[model samples]
Target: MKIKLVAEHIYNQEFSIERALNWILNSMTSEFCMRFFHEWLEIAESGTQQLTTPSWKEIIELKEKSFSKFNFRFETNSKDKQF
Candidate 1:
């Protein structure tokens, strides 16, 4: 499931990274997300000139953090399990 978390910085006009972090952490538990991260890692590690132009660190870290925070389980008999 996708979730959106905006900052509630109505008082001092400050944003909360924690809120975003929490939302991201929640999204990381999916198998699809995990696969995406794996692909992202591959691209990041390629060391090609084109891939180095944009910073992939933030994207990788955020998604990786989400995946790291939760554990996924599959009930498989043949090979892959159904959700």
Candidate 2:
């Protein structure tokens, strides 16, 4: 869900949609998608994650292996969402 929204927002243009999907897909932590993303890119001159086809198995695997951390900032009235 998050990926879809973020990808759409980032790549609102049809021309850039593929690029946006690839970025999010590569950002994922799955052995399958991680490797496959690269392979797909290698085959195609440009990269796209095939977002139309959702792979549940790969998503679960990515979620399980998702240990990488990213720093993000948030604004809140009570407190700043600090890292």
Candidate 3:
């Protein structure tokens, strides 16, 4: 799946990043936002970039690391067993 699709899917889960983004980064100064956007755009456009597909363990670790306050459980359904 595409990176955007994966992000959307994850965002649709209980832990919403939209609210977090708005409260954290979006509330920052215009110069900070511009710099952040420019950096993100540059990394996205960089042809040499390569992202490895994350394993379930890595995903869980990331979730735990980023949102330690929330309890997130990941269940593997039949459709997701392949991962």
Candidate 4:
């Protein structure tokens, strides 16, 4: 629910995704935070439209930082198993 709105804002360039990430990190304080990132990625890759290169790069960098900072392990049901 909240994640969907944030992802929509990201796609629309209404605010910095990094700012949203920071807010989630500071406020969520639970495994639930991962859902926000996952939902963003899912929406970005859903093929309704292509992300601009800069937006894509930003997402990748933020993902790496979040995973490393929190020691997150990504699991996907998709056979390709890619993030």
Q: Report the number of the highest-lDDT candidate.
A: 4
Per-candidate TM equals: 0.25, 0.23, 0.24, 0.24
- Clash count for each candidate, listed in order shown: 0, 0, 0, 0
For residues 1-83, what per-residue lDDT tens digits would candidate 3 score against the true structure? 43345445554553344553443343344545465555545444552455545456754554444432322333433444321
Find the candidate with the highest TM-score and give its number.
Answer: 1
Model 4, position 66, has a per-residue lDDT of 49
Q: Candidate 2 clashing pairs?
A: none
* Candidate 2 lDDT score at position 74: 26
Tell me how far the alpha carbon of residue 38 in candidate 1 is from the true structure, in angstroms, after superposition: 0.2
The Cα error of candidate 1 at residue 82, in Å, is 18
Report the candidate with higher lDDT, 2 versus 3. Answer: 2
Candidate 4 minimal-lDDT segment of 10 residues: 68-77
lDDT (Cα) of model 3 = 0.44
Candidate 2 lDDT by residue in tens digits, 1-54: 764565345534432435644655566546455666554444344324443543
> How high is the lDDT of residue 25 in model 4?
67
What's the CA RMSD for each of the models?
A: 16.1, 13.9, 17.2, 19.1
lDDT of each: 0.46, 0.47, 0.44, 0.52
Collision count of model 4: 0
